[model samples]
Target chain A: MIDQLIEAIIQKKSPIVVGLDPRFNQIPQAIKEKCLAEYGETLEAVAAAIKIFNRGIIDAVADEVPAVKPQVAFYEQYGLPGMAAYLDACQYAASKGLVVIADVKRGDIGSTSKAYAKAHLGQVQVGNKNYQGFPADFATINPYLGDDCMKEFEAEIVQEDKGIFILVKTSNPTSGQLQDLVMADGKHLYEKTAEIVAGWNDKICGKFGYSPVGAVVGATYPEELSALRAQMPKAMLLVPGYGAQGGGAKDVINAFDTKGLGAIVNNSRGIIFAYEKIGGDYQEAARKAVIAMKQDINDTLSSVGKQYW
Target chain B: MIDQLIEAIIQKKSPIVVGLDPRFNQIPQAIKEKCLAEYGETLEAVAAAIKIFNRGIIDAVADEVPAVKPQVAFYEQYGLPGMAAYLDACQYAASKGLVVIADVKRGDIGSTSKAYAKAHLGQVQVGNKNYQGFPADFATINPYLGDDCMKEFEAEIVQEDKGIFILVKTSNPTSGQLQDLVMADGKHLYEKTAEIVAGWNDKICGKFGYSPVGAVVGATYPEELSALRAQMPKAMLLVPGYGAQGGGAKDVINAFDTKGLGAIVNNSRGIIFAYEKIGGDYQEAARKAVIAMKQDINDTLSSVGKQYW
Candidate 1:
């Protein structure tokens, strides 16, 4: 999975991954009204609007970005219809030849974690038949339960040749409330979390010298990102908090390796809602937004003599 | 919500929550074969088996226990069909006059958390009307993202008068790998997390002198459970790790107040799969299991002069 992601980044000359985190209101007025007319303002209408809106986003950015991350929370609010829409978005993104990352942030006790691993990354057995449940190229995981619980996801990654990004430092305002607490060993909790990621990453490596077992460090904290970058040297970073979350290209510059290939920056609202802020077709605007974002990030890397291209 | 939960505990003379975390193989052969005959070898058959098995368990324990917690991971592995079964189980428990606790340890950034809160505990707006997503009485939440991210769930609790349990010390073997780390303040990380919980719980209490805001302190760690109970005085303790997790009734004594009314102990496999160990009808065995579990818990509490009844 790491090799494939790296290959995509090199081919596109952009280490950018678009986030398909859509809100109902964020969907174009035209699309929303059409769906409402068709489904009579039901949850089905909401799902339809999201699917259509996501289709536009994927078509626009599929050629520009290496991956598309769909935050499950956004679609989950509408109930069963919402889940259907979430699955459709994932399938559509895959059909476009884009790496689909399910930003699920799931983890649990070992036995339960095995079920979640099967839900997102592997196959589940039903009598003599086996079926995949919401399969994706990568999924996000929560690490609060520690290494023993993560064994299931680790096993799934090995069995399916897939990937996962475990949370280290999040981008929320109070993220440091717990993450920055100094431990008895004089290391912050997030730093300790990064050390754990580095250890796990060492057990698995791809052709590009990166691990499929990656880490998520928010782009909101540049210094912490830089520090974690050095701490988990082989980890591929899924750096969220870009754009709408107040993380500029310069703010996330340190997330990259010397060759500008170790990180994928996610921008959701800024690119998907570009049409609302800039008057034009939503798809065309999203396409332009992706191009502008890629250029901004590449420019920052080049200024530091780290641009691969 | 806390008052209602307290009233139910008083009426039932039990502070027990039956965990409906079923594994497919654990289902009685009769139920499994019936579902397989009905739906063939498909995810539908798996969902059918879960719904039927859960109904039997709920029917057996509804009069004995005040609440039932349905862990989502077990159902999620079957995809859309599994999710449908999960909702059915929640609704069935509610229909049986039992409080439904959706044991989904979900958390994320504020926006994402809002969607999750709506999905499980509150109403989501669609166009002109509001629709429910899953609508459990309470939901378990993961607290790795900190307080700012929790504001959404907090708001949902306030608006809908629902409840949530935040993970403090989990039941897994390696939960201590991160939770038991000594902080610079000379306290464990879980202790600091308990302090945070205590602070939040103080704000939103109910008529029963308890808060709808709760904390999950595993029964597996008796010492930590006792300490956390003292730390978060007003917060209800959702104690997991009972029964099949190697925790006896005596092991969970510390999770309660002197009245033995401030905590709910959860037992999954031990009660749900009792027919496999003890003969007779599955429903009858489940009823006897719940009765024995309640007696074991009450007797332990009485020995310590903490029995509420």
Candidate 2:
């Protein structure tokens, strides 16, 4: 799956992963007006409109980008109906040959963690009933519970060919307060976490020279991004904090290897809700944002003496 | 709400919070048979059986405990219908006058966090339509995204007079690998987080001397719990890792003050699924587990010269 994802990114020559974090307030006014007119403001109707909006964006960008990262919180805010829509969207993206990275950040302990892994990553069979998992190519996970909790996930990755991006250094401002704490060994917590991430990935390296175990190192910390990248050479990097979170192409360039095959830059607000920021027709605004981001990343990589795949 | 929760715990002289993590496979044979006879194995029927089982447990132990913490993952694994049952269980437990602490470790950035907070903690005002929040008296939150992510929840807590317990030191074995990382400033990451938790609660101190902002300091880390308690004197501690997770009553004693009004020990599998461990009638096994847990906590507190209420 990691190899497929890397190949798609290389073939498309795009690092931008449109973040599907839709907010009702951020939807273009025209689209919102049309959606409200078509389907009243009931939760179900609004969620349907959200799905329509997301589908349109995915269709517009599918041929030009490698993947679409859907932030689960926005859809979950609408409850179960919303989650159903989210699942549908994942299927929709996968049907278009796009990698669907479910940004859930789920973490728990032991059997519970296994349940979550089975629920989201692999097929779950109980008696005569069998349910398909979330159908995501990869998922973002919280590593706060420690490596032992991750064992179930690691095992599933091997058995099911799934991938996991463990949160190391986050993009938020306050992340430094804790993730940047110095360890007794004189390394930052995130640095130590990066070392562990590299170690974990060593056990799961795939055919593409990259591992299914990845690290979520924030694009917000460019300097740390380079350092962490150097440390976890074999690990893929899921770089969040781009665009809306104030990170730019230059900041994320170091996150990738020289081949431009090791990183995926995520921009939730910057891409999905671009019409809100730029104020234009919804589809056109979204298309323009995706093109511009793709070019920006390509140019940045090129300048760093790395060919854009 | 913290004050109310503490007062309730002290008045009941029980620190045990019954954890509602119902696994269909692990359910007693009799309960399974009853469910099969009464309802089918479809999600709706299964959820109904789960609700009945949870209601029975709540009925048996409502008078012997302060709260019931339901892990959302267990219910969420069953999808929409299961979520509906979870909501039903929450409403039922609250109607029994038990503080419902939803163990949904949700966390995200800014506005998304606000939506999640609204979904679980604050009310949802859909245009002219009115709806209460999940109606839980309190909720457990994930603080991995940083303090800013918690601001919206803080506002909701102040407005609704509810409470939130932030994950500071989790009980999982691997938690120490990141949480216990020492900083250049000499404070461990969790300790720094404890200081922030204390700051967040300073203005919201309740009449009984506790604050709305609480810390989840795992009982497994007894020494860390004592240290965190010394730092966040005014914050309530929601201790997990009791019973099944390997923490005992004596281990969590440091989380409370001499008044025995500061901590609520959570035992999910240990109480609700006690028949698996104790081997007796389902209800009787659960009742005995609760009684034994309460006695153990009371003895621990009393031995330390702390009055239970």
Candidate 3:
């Protein structure tokens, strides 16, 4: 899965992943009004609007970016209708020849984690047949539950050739409240988690020396980001906090290796709702945002003397 | 909500909560075959069977136990149909006058956490009206992302008079991998988490002096359970790892206050699937199992000189 993602990055000459974190307010007013007129300003109406808006964004940016990450929370806020929209978004992204990364930071005990793995990445068994719940090539996971919790994903990732990015250092301001605590071993909690990721990746590396297991290192913390990149050399970094979260291109560029292919920066509001700031058709604005982000990241990579390895 | 839960516990004279962690394979052969025949062995069939099984358990034990903790993973494994079953089971249990605690263990950043909280305990607004997703009195939360992650839940919990049990010391074997680490302040990670939980609960305590915010302390760790009980005196403890997870009556008693209150022990497989060990109808076996568990826990509490506070 990591190899395939890297190949897509190399082919597109872009390491940007458009985050589809669509909120009710972020959807174009015209679309919202149309859906509400049809469905009577209900959860159903909001969800329908989200699905259509997401399809437009995916269609406009699929050829420019390698993947689209649908933050599950936005859709999940509306309930079953919202989740239905989330599933449709994933399917449509996949249909557009783009990787779908479900940003569902789910974690639990071993048995429960297995259920979540099946729900997001793997297949769920019903009678003699298997069904994909929310089909995604990669899903984000939380690692607070320890190794046993992740064993479920390890088994499925190996079986299905899927991938997971474990949360190491999140982009949120208060993430350091726990993640940055100094451990007894003199490593920050995030560094210890990074080491754990490195160890897990040792068993699942692909021919390109990248692993299906990855780590989420925030773009907001450049010093920690550089250190984590060195610590987990084979782990692909899903760098969030870019653009809208106040992380600049220079800060995120350090997350990559000399090859500039190790990190994929995620920009949600900055790209998906760019029309709100730039004033244009939302889909076209999203496309333009993606192109600008790609150029900015590429320029940073080149200035740092990095190339595709 | 916590006061109501405690009063119910005192009235029922049982601090045990039945854990509805039903697996598809655990469904009775008769029930499974019937559902499969009717629904053609699809996800809908499995989910329908699960709802019926959960309703039976809830009906059989509602008088004996004060609450039901439905581990969401079991229902989630079957996909949308499973989630629909989960919501039905919760509603059915609530209708039976039992407190429903949805054991979701969900955590994320502030904005994302709000969606999860609304999805479980509170209600989500569409346009004109509000809707509850998987309505429950309380939902379990993971506090790995720190206070900001829980702030969203805290606000909603206060407004809705709902409750939450934050994961402090989980029952799983490898939980210590991150949870038990010693922090720079010389406090173990769980202890730090307990302090944080205590601080959060101060503003939410009810007239009975118990807070709606609670801690999940594994019954398996008796010493830690005792220490945590002392640490967060005002917080209710949801003690898992009882029975099937290897925590016996004596081990779990430490989680209770001198009043034999402030803690609710959860037993899933041991009670729900008791028919496997003792031959009889599944629901009857479950009822008998619940009665036996109640007797055992009461005997233990009496031996320790505890009474209703």
Candidate 4:
């Protein structure tokens, strides 16, 4: 899956992954009304609307991007039907030949962690059958619980060829409160996390010199992004906060290697909700938004002597 | 809800929360066969089997414990039907007057955090209607993203009187990797987290003096538990690592206050899977296990001159 994600980036000439994080209020009124007409002011209605909204965005951008990350929290807000819609979006994106990243941010210890690994990455077994719960090629995870806690996720990566991006430095303003704590060894907490990720990255590299294990260092912090990029050269980075969260193309330039193969920048609302700013058919607007983002990133990378082609 | 939990502890003379973390392999054969017969060898069968298994344990232990902490990982392995069963267990435990702590350990930042806060602790508004996704009195959350990321969860506690337990000092062997890191400010990471939890605890305390905001300290680390107890006096502690995690009654003794009202100890496999060792009806074994656990904890607390009644 890591190799496939890298392959897609080179083929598309775009190190971009659209984030399918739908806020019900931001959903188009026409789509919402149609769902409400069918399901009538219930969770099902909200989920149906999100399903359509996600399909529209995925269809528009699948031809231009390497991956699409569907955040579980947005779908989980509506309960079972919402999760059903989330799965539908993942499946639809995969059907379009795009790598699906389930941004669940799940982590725990021991067998409990293994259960989550099976939920998003591995397989579940019943009496005589096995089932894949959420079909994600990769999933995002929290790293507070430590390396031992992530052994199950590591096993899934090795056995099933799946991948995971562990959070290092988040995009939020106050993320520094904990992540920036200077350790007694004179290293920041995120640097320590980056070291841990780098160690793991060394264990599993694809033919292209990238590892299935990756780190998520938000593009909002360009200096940290560059520092972390240097710290974990072989680690593929999943950089959030690329657009709506106030991170510009120039800010994210540090995320990529000179080969433009080390990172995938994600923009959620900035791309999916582009119709609000551009004023057109949502699908066409979303398509145009993807092209614009691809051009913006590629042009910036080119200025730095970085190219995927 | 904090007061209610305190009251329940006093009434039952037990500050014990039975961990309803069901493992499919540990479920008795009879229940599995019945579900298999009804739903065949599908995820449906897995979910139905877990539903019955969970209900049996909930019925047995509800009378003896103040709460039941159902870890989400186990239920999530089966996807939607599994989640349906998880909700069923929460509803059933609540129906039996037990506080349902959804041990989800979910954390994200900003509106993403708000979506998760809504999923477990708050309600979602859809047009003129509102719906609660999962009926949990409290949900456990990770704290790696820092305090500001939890603002949405804080809002839910004030708005709906819900509760949350944030991980501080976990019981895992390698939890020290990140949690025990010595900061340049001369405080361990967990102490910093405890201070943060303490501040949140002060804002929304109930009449009994404990706050809806709590900390999860592992029973295996008794010394740290006692230290953190003094640091966050108003915050109730959810102590795991008891029994199956190798923490015994003696190891968890420091988790309580002089009034024996500051903490709740959890034991999952020790109680739910007791039938395998005790050799009896699963329900009866679980019931006996809960009573024995209650007695063990009360006896230890009484030895230190602590009393709830």
Candidate 5:
């Protein structure tokens, strides 16, 4: 799956996966007016507007990027109608030949964890019919419950050909309070987590020398990124905290393996609603921003003597 | 709020807060058939059935118990419509004058945590109108994200007369793998967390000598419960893993203070759907189970020379 993801990015020559976290109030007035006119104030209508807005973005970037990540909370805020819209958006993006990563940081213990795994990544039997869970190639999981809690999710990754990005180090500013705390062993908590991540991936290394089990290492901490990358050479890195979160392409360069086959950079707000910041037409601004990001990443990789698509 | 919770429980003289976790498949065949006949196969209908079932239990036991804890996951399994049913059930339970402790187990970083806190216990503005969140007297929270993640929730407790139970020692078998791991300070992880819980409750101590900040200590760990109680003398305890999880009322006695006024026992399957296990009429089985549990808890408390009720 990582190979397929990498291949798709290389073919498109863009690693951008537009994040659709359409905070209703943050959306541009023009889009909001149109959405309200079309759907009205009902939650369903609002959700439909969000889907339409996302579909427009997907339509414009289908051939330009590898995937789209829909943060589940943004949709969940609106309730069921929002969930239906999110599912629709995911299906639409997949149909456009783009991978969909469900950004739901779910973590639990044992059978409950299995239920969550089934609810999100695997099939769940409801009555006589077997309903497919969210159609995402991968998901982000919380690892605070410890490694034992991840066993069920790991089993799903093996049996079902799915992927997971365990939270090794998050992009949030206060994340370091707990994640960076020095353990008795002298290693930081995140370093300890990364070590376990590497160990967990050891049994699941793929043909491309990467593992289906991945780590979410923030792009905000470039120095830590390099150290973590060196420690977990086989784990794919999902680098958030890019663009809007103040991380540049150069900062995330060391996160990838030499072959540029082990990392995926994520820029949510910067790519999806670029018009809000860059001040141009929505599609044009998004296109330009994505192209610029691709170029910047390519330049960073080349400068580091690493392969770049 | 802890005073209210303790007083209500003591006044009623029952420790059990029937947990509403209606797994669609696990529901008895008779109830399922009746629900299917009444509501059809639609997710909304099934969720409505769950709401009705919970309402029935609340109505039957409202006078006998102090509270009802509704596990959010079971409702969330159906998505938005399910959440609506959850809201309906909570409102109905509250209407019956039963304290509703939403068993959400939610935790996130900063603003997101605040949003969840508001969505479950406080308030959030939807538009020109402000909409009430879950309106529960209390909700369960996961504290894995560290103390800062709880600031907003703690603020809500102060501002809104609400409460939160932090996950300290869980009931699941694998909980010990991470929670019981020895930390650098010679104390176990949960012990450290329990100490934090005590600190969080210091300023919020109620008239009844308990605080709004509570600890979720599973009934399965009696020794830990006794020790944790000693550590957090003023923090209320929500003891799960009772009845069906192989914990008797005796196992949870140590969680309470000497007055038997500091803990609320939770039994999901043992109370709500007792007919499935006891094999008789639904209401009859539920009523009998409630009576037996009440008696058992009173007996245990009496044996310990503690004043219950």
Candidate 6:
């Protein structure tokens, strides 16, 4: 899955992954009304509308990006029906030949963590049958519980050729409150996390000089992004906090390696809700938005003499 | 919800919440065969079998415990059918007057965090209707993302009288990797988190003098538990790692106040899979296990002269 994502990035000439993080306000009124009329104003109706909204954006950008990350929280907000929509979006995006990153930042202890790993990236067995639940090629994980908690996920996903982006430095305003804490050895908490990710990558280097084990380096912090990029050279970064969250192309470009292929910047609301700002068909606007983002990122990569494609 | 949970704790004379974390190997052979015969050994069969298994345990221990913590990862491993079992267990447990604490350690940033808060502890609005997702009285949250990520959950759940338990000092063997890190200001990371939880409690103090905001302080580290209990006096403690994970009754007792009303201990495998250790019907073994746990904890509380009931 990691090699495939890297290949898609080179072929598309864009290190970009669209984030399918739909909220009620982001969905077009027309789409909502259409689904509401069909299913009424219930969780079922709202979830149906979200699925429609996700499919439109996915269809619009499938040809231009490497992957699409569906934040589970958005779909989970609507309950079972909402989760049904989440599963549908993941399947539809993968069917479009794009890698699906289930952005479920799940982590826990041993046996419990294995359950999460099996649900998202591996297989669960019942008698002679194996079931794939929300089969995203990769998933995001929170590493707060330490290496023991992560070992299960590594055995389940990375060992199976799938991947995971462990949360190192998140993009939120107050993330520094915990992630920036200094350890006994003088490295910041996130730096320690990056070091662990880098060491893990050494165990599973891929054909592209990278590893399926990745690190989530928030693009909002350019200094940290640059420092982390140097710290974990082989890690494919899943960069978030771009566009709507105040991370710009200039800020995220620091995450790219000398080869310009080490990171995938994700823009959720900036692309999915582009229709509101662009005043055109949502799908076309989404497509145009992806192209514009691609151009913006490519311009940076080219300026830095790192544009491989 | 904080006051309600306390009241239930006193009425039941037990500050114990049974952990409904089931695995495939834990289910009785008879139950598995019956469900597999009916549903063909598919995910459906395993999930149905789990639902039945959960209901039996819930019925057995409902009179002895204040709540039941169903770790979502177990049900999630089976996919949608497993999730259906999870929801069924939560609903059935709640119907029996037990506070259903959904042990989904979920956390993210800003709007994403709000979506999670609304899904587990609050309601989602769709046009003129509001629908409850999981409807757990409380949910566990990961605080590694820091205060901004936690505020949304506080506003959504605390304001509505529901509650959340923020991870502070986890009981895992390697939890100290990040949690015990010394900050520049000299406080440990978990201690810093405890201070924040305590401050949040000041804003939403319930009738019982505790806030709806709570902390997850693992029982395995009795010294840390004692220190954190003092640091967050107005906050309730959801102490995991009690029986199965090497935390004994003596270790968890420190999480309680002088009145023995500030904490609830959880024992998953020690109770749910008790049949494996004792030769009896699974439900009977589970009931006996709960009774013994309640007795063990009560004795410890009584010896300390902190028995509120």
- For every candidate in turn, the CA RMSD to the true structure comes to 1.0, 2.2, 1.4, 0.9, 2.9, 1.2
| Candidate 1 residue lDDT tens string, B1-309 | 778888999999999999998888889899999999999989999999999999999998899999999999898889899999989998888888899999989989988999999999998888679998887999888888998757888877888889999999999998998899998879998998888889888898998778988999999999999999999989999999999899999899989898777999999988988898898888999898999999999999999999887
Q: Rate the local accuracy (lDDT) of all candidates.
A: 0.90, 0.81, 0.88, 0.90, 0.78, 0.89
For residue B175, give model 3's deviation from the true position in Å: 0.6
User: How would you encode candidate 1's per-residue C-alpha lDDT over A40-153 as one tens digit per residue?
Assistant: 979999999999999989988888999999999888888889988988988899899899889999989988888999998889999999988787899999988898767888
Q: Model 3 - which docking category? A: medium
User: How big a share of the true inter-chain contacts is recovered in candidate 6?
Assistant: 0.75
Off by over 4 Å in 3: none
| Candidate 4 regions with alpha-carbon error over 4 angstroms | none
For model 3, give the interface RMSD: 1.5
DockQ for every model comes to 0.84, 0.49, 0.65, 0.82, 0.35, 0.77
TM-score of each: 0.99, 0.94, 0.97, 0.99, 0.90, 0.98
Quote the TM-score that chain A achieves in each candidate: 0.98, 0.95, 0.98, 0.98, 0.95, 0.98
lDDT of 5 at B226: 94
In candidate 5 chain B, where is summed lDDT lowest over 10 consecutive residues? B124-133
Evaluate residue B261 in candidate 1 and report its C-alpha lDDT on the 0 to 100 scale.
75
Poorest 10 consecutive residues by lDDT, candidate 2 chain A: A124-133
Candidate 6: CAPRI quality band: medium
Residue-by-residue lDDT tens digits, candidate 5, B1-309: 777888788788887788887777766677667777776666666676777677777778889888998887566556545667778878998998888998867776565577667667776444444445456889888766677667879777998899999889988776775567565566676887787788888878889888899999999999999999999998889999898888997799999888777888898888877888888766677788999998998888999988555
- Tens-place lDDT digits, model 3, residues A257-305: 8867789999999999999999999999999999999888888888888
Q: For model 1, what is the C-alpha lDDT against the true structure?
A: 0.90
Model 6 misplaced stretches (Cα beyond 4 Å): none
Better DockQ candidate (3, 6) = 6
Candidate 4's docking class is: high
